[model samples]
Target chain A: MPNTFAVPDYFVSPTLLTRARTIAQEHASLAKRLATDYDVSAARRLGELQSTSTAVREYDEAHSALEELQSLLTSTDQELRELAEEDIQPTRDRIEQASAALKSSLVPVHPFAHLPCLVEIRPGAGGDEAAIFAGDLVRMYKGYCARVGLRSTQLKYDTADEPTHVQEAVLEVDSPGSYGMLRCEAGVHRVQRVPATESKGRTHTSAASVLVLPSIPTEGGGDMGEASFDDPKSDYYVDPKEVKLEVMRAGGAGGQHVNKTESAVRLTHLPTNIVVAMQDSRSQLANREKAWQLLRSRIAQLRREEREEEIAKLRRGAGAGKVGRENKVRTYNWGQQRVSDHRSGLDVRNLDNVMEGGEALERIMQSVRTWMAEQEVLSLVAEEENSQAQKK
Target chain B: MPRLAPSLLRQARAIDVLLPPLLPACRDLRSAENELRWLKDHAIKTGRQCGLAHSDASLKRLVARRARGEPIQYILGTEYFGDLELKCQPGVLIPRQETAASVTHLAQQLSKKRKGRPSDLHILDLCSGSGCIPLLFHHEFYAQPGNEHCKLHMVGADISVQALELARRNQKSQIAAQSKRVTAQTTSLAAMRFLHADVLLSEAANAIHAPIGVVEALQQLTNTRPTPAYEVLISNPPYISSQAFRTTTARSVRNFEPKLALVPDNPSSAPSALDGDVFYPRLLALADQLRTEIILFEVADIDQAQRVATLLARQSTWRTVEIWRDEPGATSDEADHVLLDGGESVPVRGAGNGRSVFAYRGAAAAWLQ
Candidate 1:
């Protein structure tokens, strides 16, 4: 059954073709009965025919068209041959497009697609360069958000020990559906650039990781279509008992005021170990509130990822192993001025423009979206084949 | 300093005497633990240069002082105020979170005009200790893109020469360290500098208005007042009354930080409750003298802020005298005549509990609307 619905590769599954043929034949008889007897029951049966088996009707129409075209190909006249040659391609394309559209529609929409997102960027390997690159990525996102009419706010910006680079940053892109748009950006982003600290001209590899999570309200992931973190009823709500809160003076820096004032709050979810430390606010309460909001989003993201993994494992067996396939997504090479997205396997030049978050960045994101759609369609087709095979 | 090495965290954990255990509250223990981690990191970094023994002795002294309630900022000799990492010294009071918040709010309102600022934006910070307010504002303003062309002419004015020297040192280090981080490369020709001037004196106030004693402040001071009718006037002036400072203020602050930066000067032998508010009228007079439009002051608390607003109401200089707060009030805009700016938008700096007073005219005057 898994290989049965490999459409056209094996002339559609015999079982599926037979099913469609049976439906078509049944529909023909019901139509004929309704025309002759003129009974309401017969008419109703005929009316529901297309709805019951869409594939059968489409196959019926295309089969008949192909039969007529096959006959035309055998005609002696040159004009008839030419006409068949021209008409055959478009008809086939129409059927393919229609079938794909139908197959894709069968798959449910991603649950978190409509929700806004928070993107957490952190340094991975390369020391100062990695931190600088992380900061660069933050700027790029903020610029891109500005260009796209999305309000991007920095919730937390942890300065590095080096002081020049940001150690960590959380940006909330406050537009609905940004999660779907930015989720593809999750994974490690590699940068190849000659360090300013480097004396000799040589390229060094550095990496920054982007973790995109749906911006759930800290209180509740409400059914009201609005997420609030304060709502105990919210799916995002972390039980107070489950979280350990820690308050410290703002990092050892920021003068005596930052040192004496215990303003920084860190929230550690016991089960998940997802810790969100916030010290930007001078007040402990404010910091705690921010930490909760971040923790909720992160935990919600973690759960969503787990769910995706489950779906991925199913899709891999049922269709293709695209889910849980890859993580290293993109690379920014400064010397060559190239940005290559591994997901789409697209190598785009103008690294600076991409860093500026211009059209090149959009193009790369669009390619990721297109690639995602194809994977989704493939998985949906596979799932349909599995279900249909089991019925057989 | 060195990303708080594991050894440092372990070291802080081992100590029970100097590093007190934080309460379960998320705000308490983390900072103390964090500072120890940084101190260890700094110690390691210093050790790299001067050997372990040299680092050990100095670190021991710093740690011992911290145990005795000396601020870690003074020990580390550095502070991150907003976007800028300013140099900290003993005489100059460290920049408060309340000041950082008030300055942030001020910068946002001023930068709303963005690129097409009529001319250069002139800001004057009175009682500017460590020059943290103006220094941070300069750095934060330029940190964002599209602010490359924003000519932010800044002046940090203080009465204490020590503060002025410390402010200059902060200015120098900030430029040295954060020059690459921000857009304003060298901070224009004479944009960022410190000046010595007492706001309490009309003689010093006249120094800015007429061509009188401002020359002396200029001959002596590197920074001066700019021409375009000072649009923004900000201060974290001393507002703590003697009674409140004695009771409410922390022992760490009382023992270490300068008193000049926290409380007002006594005009008479016996200081009254009104003595704390002496700067509000002087600042009001200075604002009136210079035609300063937007004004923000960091008061001790909401009650003191309310009194400042009342004092502001007496004068016709300001059209709106609003108190921006973080706490949830009964209403959005209050009957108390203080406008509530920045509702849930930008986080307010006060004590994280609404306490700063803002008096203004011109575009920024209409905060709530």
Candidate 2:
């Protein structure tokens, strides 16, 4: 039987109700604009304009604005949903008395918010047994992905020899709630078990580390525009002496043409000693443009790194050194069949069920959210104390 | 002015006459001439001067072997890299030109970095194969001033015993040829040891056959040194992707090398069971633990290089990853900005050639941070 759960009455606090009304009105306005203003005829004309020189800029600007508006609507909807949940949680006991719901639906917010997490799990010092445990940890993740209905994509993977053991594997899990849920899964995971390959069933210790990154929206993705590059209004010329351009015939996997022509252009920035080559393009101009694109991205990446460093420095001053430090996070001991998240201080004994994912993940996710809420409260209290001290 | 000696001209003529039959199919006149000159010089130095006709026959056989897809070095039984004559064996991956470039880079860096001109530097070469890397380093470092006091305590590790034996032979021949050079050293024996070890093995016992003391010494040198045990960590491990193994033409695959070295053994293993790129991660982990100051890893192409850069960027420890090309005169920070998929120009750094990842640990972090 599917258990039914109701949203509690206290969840509908006055502040939350006002916020929800404002969000609904904004969403309605966006819906109206999307329907009436964004007509099929205009879209077709816009597509045509996109291909033409005269109207292309206008078309692009319009498209960007539309995208921004749509994102705004989506964000507003998300915020309203979170507010609803906050209001509902206060009346949790009343909701439980109301109905038994099999599928518990809380607003599924993207879990990796606010905190950048580091996951580290390595095969412990125990030889093949350690390696084997590393392999199991990787599988446990895959199983966890399935349970959470998350998709696991290989960011990188390294395979061992015959009698297969995973030397190392890094996987990126895509889910709304992954970063928050997997944050609990960082640090040294120790495994104690008899190797399947061993004749004498002797227990050995192994370890693996997992790092979770809350996939931040890129610079221009949302309201986080601080890191986005402001395009220089004026054209800047690279000193002729500073730039070295070499034309070469591109090689590898590409066809005979790859070896035939000097289509590939290698640009060397002498000042920075950075070299970018683009041979994938058919023409030299295209290749140069491609190379420039790569260069810009790198510069942008550097800027992003600088911003992160500054924020980290500030955080250190604020006495939250342990929050973002890439040291210890979590541990999984296969011998004990236990997984522990050091940050939240939560331990789950059912390794198999957790690895398999789903309901097991829900419990872990709840624990993480509670931890996050407590941290927020602590931060608020600290701020209040600082203000009070200033007045005194 | 020194004129061309008649005897030298005569030998050159003899080598020239023998070269045609040796390289009948080869069209590059310059390459053929270079080969002949090299071989003739070797023959004359060894005092095993051959008649013009006999030299022709030998050259022809060597050329024929090359034409039949055998590496020229393997056919000749030797190849000179740096100052060492390394043995080239069948089934072993030949030392590549890019590898030579990286070795030279490391040697130059090490010479500049090390203090007091120490008589010997402890160096470990994993996946040593024919021990070309250690041999080159030994030859170069020994030739430097104050290096006479410098003993090169070198260890070459490889899982293949056959390869290890071949490497040992190569080292022996090199040491014998340079015995006079070796005698200039004042320190204890310039120890050169080979241990059969699989880097992939989590346990040392699964791989190494050395005595406990030796093992402990090596481990200590690797871990506890005020400076890293090895001034430089260099490896050209099997980096061929599984996709390449599966999809490469038969001419390149079946005709050239062993599948064991090229592809991961079990293709059908679960995603969790297999690491797609095995050597790179292991090297990274080793670097992390051993804290080796410098690492030079050979990769296939730009895509792999980019993947490595991304992998390194994700790590807290690794920083300042710059790719190098096979070509000379390549700079590390040569930025050529081009637009990306979103039409944004990104700065390109390093040798924009066949992909090679050259990164330093603390330096890059310090620079960027």
Candidate 3:
């Protein structure tokens, strides 16, 4: 069979190899330090570098094997030359696999990659039809999580008057590292189908936006040092002063005089004007805690995106333009029964399988993840080229 | 109360037949919906556990009980105080968010002062309703990594036997919930005790059988502290005056919560102060007797907080005194100060109505500052 997994005619870039070597060296020193005296940040960094160091080792071994095989190709014996030639192709293929792994491992790991995520789905366009599609997407995600054996909870599901219509829904994928696996599903998703609300039998275009955020634990999980709110340098660290907390309590005496059960809590990050309101839990304390968590996740995501935008501007790949939240990442065409990922350019004919979050959905997500890693490598190459040009 | 709109009631009824019954107490559609959801969840869980009749029937009954102005905490039998969920009964006052906020703020300050150094700490809560204050304090303080090493002794005293019983039940449930997170070796539940005592009556005024004073009762209950000098004294005592209870208290509170927890008995007997203000003098005297370093007393509003602060100032015992608003940590633009009858004034921290009077003396002066 043809090796479809192989990147066609791929070669390892010198800049990427140099980056990988430095990472391997850092990993070695971190491992030594970790053995003698343990530190949380040091351990976490070491974990991130594990894959990069492995890939570097594999690449080095494959390159040496290929060179050894090439040297034997020059043997005076005809039998030896033929054997060396036959083995060279396989060794070269091994080298190509290592190169691809090395390239992907160099892409910076997302800071929130280890955390469980909150997937928020909101209708973007096409009014009522968009709302219906948003509902479908919510179910699709829930189905995906169930199929994958990931624990999921619907944090907030606001439904409209019509059946199968949703205003907004937030699904908390409660499995750790789900953020890393599901983050590529973010951005606008466009859908084309004949809506139930439609009078005419014509296909119409609608869109819904998906936002995935890290669900940071509230207390005692302080081991997530950088993600914990106590650290001022952490993106999750929100100044208590900047937040405005509103409780829906009766105006009269609050303590013993009132027995009101209104437990809704709203927190607004005043600087960014990001508001998170939670009334899902009957306990006021629980609602307040959930609100604070949602607020922190959103603020952290915003801050990280802002930093990414600055880096992307510097990297500036011409063909690799940034596909942000506004850009359509995937399309679901009901008429053609096709689900297409815009970035990966992968299309699946089984619409039912995609909507059911079956193998087709997994295939699309895997393609997008690969496409994202390639984009990261392209940006790294672009950065190297920019710096070299400046040196000239 | 004004009548709920027909349209709103219909809307609630449309949501769930049980939801409309909650609208009168909840006063709005959103809260009614929330209460109904919680009630339904409570019904199913408890019914299934106890093997009771249908949860749907129980849900209808719970909705009816809520409509008649019963506190949801009492109906559900649990209320969240800080991170600890305390069991609630009708007689014991439900733990308030304001009280939790003050307790949390104090715990944060205490932990910050400890700075990983372990030391013996004792807390006394007067008129402890569901034992919420001390249990919450223990939860917050021991949440820090090094605090489990520190010897924590807590005493919660209430006049009513029912309150004390609920307090002990709350402690058991808290320990059960806490044991899942922490190892048994470091559990401070042993050091915590609940006693039945009336703060208003002096030891001389009461019979030998009935414990009247906090310090005397605590010494009788525990062997570790024969004469305990607590580090902190906290209380959310019955502070609402008889007139306020009649004029200002909510219908749910007036109709359902224990009257012993809401209004102090016999205002005419306490000649010097308002009926609600009667508890402060007794608590202050107890604080002095116990040699309590820090005291936090919950009040009705700014006026009451000022009155309590003035009472504390008259003794010149505390090094520093501050009144904290509903949210003690929140920043505000307005100048926060409560003007006393004297030319001097005390600083008020945070925003909203002044909810607590916080004072620290001796070693605690340095900790709070």
Q: Quick one: best DockQ, which candidate?
A: 3
lDDT for each residue of candidate 1 in A130-151, tens digit (9 for 90 to 100): 9989999999999889888888
The best-first sequence of candidates by lDDT reads 3, 1, 2
Sorted on DockQ, best first, the list reads 3, 1, 2
**How is the predicted docking of candidate 2 categorized under the CAPRI scheme?**
incorrect
**Candidate 3 chain A: 10-residue stretch with minimal lDDT:** A1-10
Query: DockQ values for all predictions?
Result: 0.05, 0.01, 0.37
Better-scoring candidate (DockQ), 1 or 3: 3
Q: List the residue pairs that clash in candidate 3.
A: none
TM-scores for candidates 1 onward, in order: 0.50, 0.39, 0.77
What TM-scores result for chain A when each predicted structure is judged separately against the true chain A?
0.76, 0.45, 0.85
lDDT of residue B45 for candidate 1: 86
Rank list by TM-score: 3, 1, 2
Candidate 1's C-alpha runs over 4 A off are A1-259, A263-275, A278-392, B1-29, B53-58, B113-117, B143-147, B178-190, B204-228, B269-271, B326-351, B362-369
- Evaluated on the second chain alone, the candidates' TM-scores are 0.77, 0.68, 0.92
**Model 2: per-residue Cα lDDT over B1-369, one tens digit each:** 134445544433454555454343233333345454445554444434433433545645555565454545555566545444567777765555445556765566555544533444556677777888877766666555555555566777776767888888887776666545436332222467777666665444533454223234456545753434554467777666565655532332345545445454535453522333677777777666556656777666555556666666667465455555554335655444333334323334445454456666664233222
What digit string (tens of lDDT, one per residue) describes model 2 on residues A1-392? Answer: 11223134212223222333343445455555657677776555444322222222332343344344444544658885565555443344433322111001112233234322222235556676667677676777777676657777643344343224556555556554456667555546556566787798776655555545444332324432232223242112234466677756324432100111233568887776767666543344555655554444334334444555655543344443334324445555567887766656788887677666546555765676566544443333344445556789
Please, what are the lDDT tens digits per residue for candidate 1 over residues B1-369?
124445444544454334542211113344555565567778878788775655766666667777677766787777656445667888788776546656666666555655435446767788888888887777666655566776877777888889888888777776666445434445542357677676766663433443233234543554445523566788888877777677666667778888888778666453655466778877877777667777888776566666677767667566666676532221233333433232212223222345577766765455423
Name the runs in model 2 displaced over 4 angstroms.
A1-392, B1-60, B113-121, B142-152, B179-189, B204-231, B245-254, B257-276, B327-355, B362-369
